[model samples]
Target chain A: MIGELELILCDIGNTTFHFLIDDVEQKYFLNERLPDFNETIYYISVNDNATANLKHSNDDLVDLEQYVNFKTKYKGMGLDRKIACIGYDDAIIVDAGSAITVDIMKKAKHKGGFILPGLKSIKDLYPKISHKLQFDFNTKVNLDKIPLCTQDAISYAILQSIIEPIKKIRKKQQIIFTGGDGEFLSKYFENSIYKKDLIFENMKRIINANNCIA
Target chain B: MIGELELILCDIGNTTFHFLIDDVEQKYFLNERLPDFNETIYYISVNDNATANLKHSNDDLVDLEQYVNFKTKYKGMGLDRKIACIGYDDAIIVDAGSAITVDIMKKAKHKGGFILPGLKSIKDLYPKISHKLQFDFNTKVNLDKIPLCTQDAISYAILQSIIEPIKKIRKKQQIIFTGGDGEFLSKYFENSIYKKDLIFENMKRIINANNCIA
Candidate 1:
């Protein structure tokens, strides 16, 4: 762990093409601007120590060692999972955004969580099925706290599905919530915490796990 | 009025299927069984009067008299509004079922209400748009409480949409909750009351409005 940035972190989720560079301040940049039209999620991170124009392999994950041409070795890993498991040593982590996700790790046993549709996902559905609903949520409408109707129902349900499972699993356990919808979830639980800078923290964890410095 | 039935009721909503059988007891019968999709909603008070068929044309709703054929009239009148109007000389009616409807009648207004999807409607939308979640609900399952999760959020949001608007529009006005999901909503308000057979009640009102059986 004696270099300035041992490994780069790549994460792909809702919108693919995410790359994070581990740094002491835990600063990292993501390419969330990728077009959602691609069928597969592909990304790679080059080791600062080695050189050989790094690129993603045919498979969804990245072989960090092969990509960077590093002398030392590490197996291929999924970008989303690696990024998710980055900061914590032993804890349950959830990423609820466009799609709600729950991932758990205890004693190195990988127990997966669930993934449901995200909030805005509804707006994308109705028009295809029936033009009548026109689930257009962006129509300059102010939704009430309790929600008065269909539009509010859409937002409320999306938020509920994402957070409820975490509540049941968080007894005597630490829960971390992140994603663009973090604020929506934080409203439900007073004890739970929200982290907007999860990508940066993920980079830090990946660096620490590999005994690399950033 | 020569009819033995003292109460004349009518019910109507998005679908106009109740022709005109303006009896309070009959209205009660239909509204109570609105969700009985397994059986046909048509009922013949056959023995009540040998000629009840040829002369009845929905004995209660005269407004719908122009479209006659007493033997079968469930398809004649304004569907969701009338029974919601019945038993009330003046008030606002809210039917929260497959869709949340808010109809207002200051007595002078013929029909007034907006249509929006209900809890099931929202749930149905989720599974279609969401790759993972599939909507499933049993007719036997009835939720009278606010849901803390996605399922509840959907149910509550749709319910609230109906309740809150009715609260805002006519202060101290009687808010009548009806339709398939009526039970769940009646519990929400101190000012609200529920009518199980809205369309049936309206059918009777239409008959009386038409001076069909008085």
Candidate 2:
């Protein structure tokens, strides 16, 4: 007779740490709050400095570069990206979080990728120049051509900043969008599927495959 | 018989005010250091407040939206943009200054336009997030795909930001690029021509046509 499997998976990001255990998911800030979990923690981190401060079995951490099944020429692929690519075998995976990553995975192989500032990050960055330049995500602006007003102009610019790269990469391939702004930006893409907790889903696969065992 | 034509043409922009008179060109700060020129300035402005401060005869300043020969539905179109599109009768006029304006004109008609932050402005905006994000204009980067390093990624993003819009607007039309960063961005664009002082050139035509007399 076998007992129930017990495991704790954590994706240590730059801002927040996402945790999944026994199909229950929770998130905490990397700096402000720390959860009370006692299980064997299997983790993948984008921020090494913050991850180092945490207490975990060193061997249980997932090496994203080695955890993947496919081969990649990019030596500096981040942990978040490597996990996002897992199971998304043959599609363009776009992570629109703090940073927008447009990584092309054609036939289970990483062709290439791009990283640009996210919608929030760009909106935040632009305010330093002119406080009037604001991105209203709720404001529906047409992308068929240039927008007229400042708000719409900014909204369109931010949208194009993300979409243009995907268009450059999308050659009739399915696009899988994930991240904070994925829900908002995905609607604009014709052939895109928005999936939340993608990193957590990838983490589950990685943990189940015993890839997190260092 | 025509007399020796003399005029002071001013381009009131977001940041600086560019002035030209009888082949003598000068610029003044939009806020801090005003120019010492006392000539009756024939001007077009994006900054109405700044233009209001400057002393000009009632008919000296040109109404951009009304002065242009072509018709446009965009009510808030800046004067600099209207002037840039003057001589570019049948082409895409891209002005990459404080703001990158891509206005498509076909057969002497305004099709539509896009507005994005300029390269310098984008570079300036990025540093607020991470001081490490330094934009070295001298560094040449590959825009075929997303770059690897942070600096290269940013460089590629900024370059892509400009190039991608032009690609979308381009439909076998002659591309005319002019601005502070126009010379730099023009190299990446194929079959494109870079022309400096395009606004000034357009201003000459506009003033001679008595568009400012309105």
Candidate 3:
């Protein structure tokens, strides 16, 4: 809890607007109008439209991108991904949202990362290839064995494909899973931590560091 | 060579009509008219439109789906995948065309398989998710390390995701890489055989067994 900071934090993505106020979390769709709030909202957004909407509203807004001073060699990295890595010094950060962004943080600096189509994106893609390929992923799929059926096969390919590279790259570091699908994906890994409010927590850290309680 | 058999084998996919005549391979786009061949062509197709087109053509065609006697518990398996596993008694058959189908053939019996979107499908998907993800894959990406750039990261995820599962399932069995992308994906694996004519060779085996050289 960010005691006495009295900060209302917002993390906006392509689809949803996530807000945390007075230690209470709330979510709103991007299309919906911004909620009327009395407190100033400090926010980071990857969506330009959302940022624009928030700026035009009568609410007090502080764009937090200016407050982040993280170091990384990766270019064109998403703002949400950058903020998520703020407090992690040595961890593999897997943000599984509309897109899964896997980044490596070492010695409190960004070591770079990769992006994969999220579970929903992958699910939507299969049927576009062929109707025969259309099947829901078996979420409880056994990744250790090669699947013999179509459903399990698709599930294995989707899950194992994402899991293997993370396993390969992880060496003596705890994997931190965040974002929407993070909980579902974290089940397959060992020595991993799932923190849904990772971004918000880091957002609070940034606020504390900058002392931007104005 | 299908010596003395004098057979013309065709493999029809969604995009191309692949023909092997007198051991000479030729390819024609699906939109183009079928070649005016004199010899009777034996073929297996996963594309309904192509199958219908060939049926309406003047060319002599034999559908080999009736001749296959393979055993598997998998339902709704594509005819193309079934035929590709014809002669491989113990191998991981990877047909890397528009869709990469990985099947295990054990003792000349089907043990079922899984499917992944081909490289092109994967390449096309990234951009649809985000404009930042629109970069072309680094074909020569080093999969051993976590990539520090966007291009290598996407490439590693795409390539390693596919490779690791195939390696995991393969135990003392040869990995047979076929289809359009077969030769390219084969470079990452050791003790893997790239058989461009795998489906055609298997088709010939079916022809020999059935003695349908009428």
All candidates: interface RMSD: 12.1, 2.6, 1.6
Candidate 3 lDDT score at position A25: 91
Q: Give the C-alpha miss distance for residue A214 in model 2, angstroms.
A: 13
- TM-score for each predicted model, relative to the true structure: 0.45, 0.83, 0.92
- Selected candidate, larger DockQ, 2 vs 3: 3
Candidate number that wins on TM-score, 1 or 2: 2
Sort order, lDDT high to low: 3, 2, 1
Q: In model 1, what lDDT does residue A159 have? A: 40
Relative to the true structure, candidate 1 reaches a TM of 0.45
Docking class of 1: incorrect
The chain B TM-scores of all candidates, as shown, are 0.53, 0.83, 0.92
TM-score of A-chain in each prediction?
A: 0.56, 0.85, 0.94
Task: Please give the distance, in angstroms, between residue A78's alpha carbon in candidate 2 and its true position after superposition.
Answer: 1.1
Error of 2 at B45 (Å): 1.9
lDDT values, one for every candidate: 0.45, 0.71, 0.84
**In model 1, what lDDT does residue B166 have?**
48
DockQ (Cα-based) per candidate?
0.07, 0.39, 0.67
Candidate 2 C-alpha lDDT tens digits along A26-129: 77786754655655677778777768755532434444445556568765677678788887667888888777877888777787676666677677655655
Fraction of the true interface contacts (Cα pairs closer than 8 Å across chains) found in each model: 0.04, 0.32, 0.73
Q: Give RMSD to native, each candidate.
A: 12.6, 4.1, 2.3
